[model samples]
Target: MEKIVIIGGGFAGLNLVKRLDPEKYRISLVDRNNFHCFPPLFYQIASSGLVSANICFPFRREIKKMKNVSYHMGHVKQIDIAAKKVTTSYETLEYDRLIIAAGSTNNYFGMENLAEETFGIKTVAEAAHTRDEILDRLERGAICHDPERRRRLLTFLVVGGGPSGVEIAGAIGEMKKYILSKEYPELKPDDVTVTLIEAAPQLLGAMKKKSRDRAVKDLESLMVNVRLNTGLKSYENKYVTFADGHKEYYETLIWTAGVKGEPIPGLPPETIGRGNRIIVDEYNRVKGYEDSIMAVGDIALMQCEAYPNGHPQMAQPAIQQARNLAKNLNKGEFRHKFEYLDKGSMATIGKNRAVADLKGFSFSGFFAWLTWLFIHLISILGMRNKLSVMVNWFWNYLFYSTSLRLLLRPTRFPLRKHWGD
Candidate 1:
């Protein structure tokens, strides 16, 4: 049997493995994280709607039933194409065929100073840190008597008007209205401000024109300040300078602005393209490698007719690409090229409002929210995770209060300040 080694146990790698029959090959999957996180609802976790553990599913337990499959937990440093071996932190391994599903990272767009000032919502760790950071600022605001400084600390700026940005802004809006109102009776709902900024002229740039128009209107109705075709030109600490020569101080800055593929060492610079994606041919073969190496998911820049530049680096595209490649790899027939199956995209603004663009149909409001919740719940990894999340949502819906709001504090104000507020 042939040996297959995959790097990055994200949606792409795990889904690919599911499509492959274990008896046909020996497979080893590697990732820096031991658990698989559901990416769609990461905003809920960040906004305190869900706990970190609730969204995480251990990879080993989930994949344990497969006989021929194995798992490794580590960061892959380089690929030695000449020897057909991959060098990771623990050990070096060889494979008859390789899949580079190694994921993406937050892109700063070469603005080093600004990158230091902003945070990206990409990983479970980052998401949790962001949640703690927001709550920490609120605690400080509660005691400070300076009204102007308090307003600044309470003001939240969300950069990048994409789905993550939209969702985060909406969630924060809900937090300001419902969660904050219930928790801090001293602070009025009007004291907390949530702003959404995007360099593009509209939000959800890839969606239909009407959908984008409706999203902006819905967000405004939700009291989320939407600023389009605008962004931070530079930032230092809490002060951000925008392109319009306006500088503002904000305590909480949620950066969902940009992303670039995580750079893999040892691949020639020529193989990399814009956004650091590994340029792959129509068949998803990494450029300059005939059959020994391939890439999928966010790491691969697959060029095709429907997606002349490359398909959207979303979960559905990744899952479809992985399955297509797995089918060809299990057999000797490697003739088919990977094609994306367009499953419509959706975004939720608040409790009962959302926008969805299905293949030929577009829906919004209550039905769209239902679609969003059902799809996300079904996509969650394990049964316990699903049940825990469902219960939390149920309780929140009825009571308008999050179950776990107590600060897991370090107990000393000085120590908390040292951690950087």
Candidate 2:
């Protein structure tokens, strides 16, 4: 049995484990967090639509059934490619083969100030923090005397036009229209504002033109301010300066702007490409390291004729690459070149509104929403998580209420400032 060490317990690494034969490979999985977080539904956590536990799964419990698989919880500091050693926070791991599927992190694009001030919803903790900030602002605004301050507290800004940004903007809009007004009667519905800023001319740039237009219209119908041909210049505490030299005031700035690959150290500089992704060959093997190393998920950049750049940094590509690599490893030789099966994409814009581009057929509205719900539900990891999400969806649909809106603030002045201060 080969000693296979997999770094990062994200979608790619975990799927690789499932596809590999334990009898043929002794696996070691390492990640900073002991649990795997479902990224697709992370917006739900930030919006208070679902709790973190509903989407997070513990790795220890998952690997308990696999006899040859071991779990290590730590961050990889460096990978010694020459020695076949991976130096982590805990110990030096030696492996016959190493798989790098460490995934991605928020790309602040060199704006350190904006990165510090803005809230991101990438992890469970980050999502929870954003939710806390939103609820805290609402609570403070309810009794605030200054109208300007109150308005600032109620304003929400999402700084991207991708799926996460669209979903977040829509969720916040629906929350204001449905949840906030009912829960905090002192706060008027008009006081809350949800604005989505996109650097691109259209939202969901990868989708078809009709689908993008449908998403914009749906967001507008839900009372979300969709700003296109606009970009962020700077964020100074409570003020947002746009690239067009316009300024807007908001308390919460959710940074869903972009993401870059989270590459680990030790690989040659040439193996890395734009967006920090590890450049791989047709077989998903790291460039110049065909036998000893491989990469998958958002971190692996395999540029082909169809995608001269690389496949979209998405779950489908990551999982497919992992499976393909596992199959090749099982055959004891690289047998096939990895090909992406483009399985379409969808984005939900509040309750009965969504846009889907499925194999060139674009559609929107209630049917699209249902399709989105079904696909996401089936894509979730565990049975319990799927059930919990379904129950939450039904509950929100029937009553327009979210029970997970607890302000779990860990520090004093979690919002960085107080109302009328």
Candidate 3:
């Protein structure tokens, strides 16, 4: 039996395996995580609109039906190309073929300290951590009596004007208006400030001009402080300095600026391109090895006619490429080269404000928001998870928000007795 080893088990890896036949190859999937996190709804989790369980699906549970595919929770340490084997934390994997689906990481733009200080929504655990961080600051504000401290603590600085940043800031904005109002009366809606900083002049620079204009308008309507043509240059403890000689002190900073590809060892430095992505041909195969090894998702650089620098590093492109590659992999080189289909892009501002740019048609406002919800709900894996998320969304729509908004405790605390001190 031929061994097919996959490095990462996210959207790309899982989607590739979905099209694979059991009889042809004995599949071995390796990931650092045990659960597959649905990336799209991570913002909902961070904003306290959804729970952790709603966004996380067990990969083992989902794929236990396939007898050929064996899932393992391990990290890939190194790959020995000459020996045709991989060194992992668990064991050495000798593979007949290799697929590198290792995804991207948050780009701090060379600012390492800022990366450490900021909270980014990349994984399930990061989302949970962001939620806890946001909640903890708010709770801390309720107890702190100092006016300046309260002001600093309540301010949330979201870096980048991309979909993730915009959506997160928007969600936090909604939490302030609808939910946080009913919960914390002491703090006014104005008290909780959500700042969105972008290096570009307009928000969602990837979208159309009309859509970008509408999105900026929608966000400004929600009173999200929009700073354009500004970048985070340097940072200390709580202070962030921008390129334009402007700085702000923020207690909570959510990073969504940019991302780079996951590290691949034992590869020549020349093959690596911008964003640390592995440079590959349009066939989704590594530069030299067209048959033996392949690359996909955010890590792969499929520079083509439409995308000279490779496709946009988004979930849609990754999933589409994976599905296409899987079919082509089974069929051989005679198969047509993969071309990305542009469905659309959306950014949700608060509860009712959203903008979507389709291939020809563009939409905004309440209807667009509804479309966004339905698309996300459908994209999520598992019937049980979809139903749970739908029900919770409806519940949130009915009631203002959750009454049980407590900061998640990662570790249990011990009982301490207080005498007559």
My TM-score estimates for the predictions, one after another, are 0.95, 0.96, 0.95
Off by over 4 Å in 1: 409-421
**How do all the candidates rank in terms of lDDT, highest first?**
2, 3, 1
Q: List the residue pairs that clash in candidate 2.
A: none
| Candidate 1 clashing pairs, residues 3+ apart or interchain | none
lDDT of 2 by residue, 92-161 (tens): 8899999999999998888878767989998787899898888899889999989888987888999999
**Total backbone collisions for each predicted model:** 0, 0, 0
Residue 95 lDDT (model 3): 90
Candidate 2 shows a clash count of: 0
Tell me model 3's lDDT, rounded to 2 decimals. 0.83
lDDT of 3 by residue, 1-421 (tens): 6788888888899998787667777888888887787887888889888888887788888888987998877777788988888887778888988989989888887888866788989878788899999899888887878888898899899998999999998888777777666887677777788899999898898899988988888777777888888888887788988897877898889998898998888777877887899988777878777667888899999888888888898888889888888887676452867889988898888667889997789999989989999998888888999999988888887886774366877664555332101
- Candidate 3: give the clashing pairs: none
Error of 2 at 225 (Å): 0.6
What lDDT would candidate 1 get against the real structure? 0.83
Cand. 3 TM to true fold: 0.95
Write down the lDDT of every candidate, Cα atoms only: 0.83, 0.90, 0.83
Ranking by TM-score: 2, 3, 1
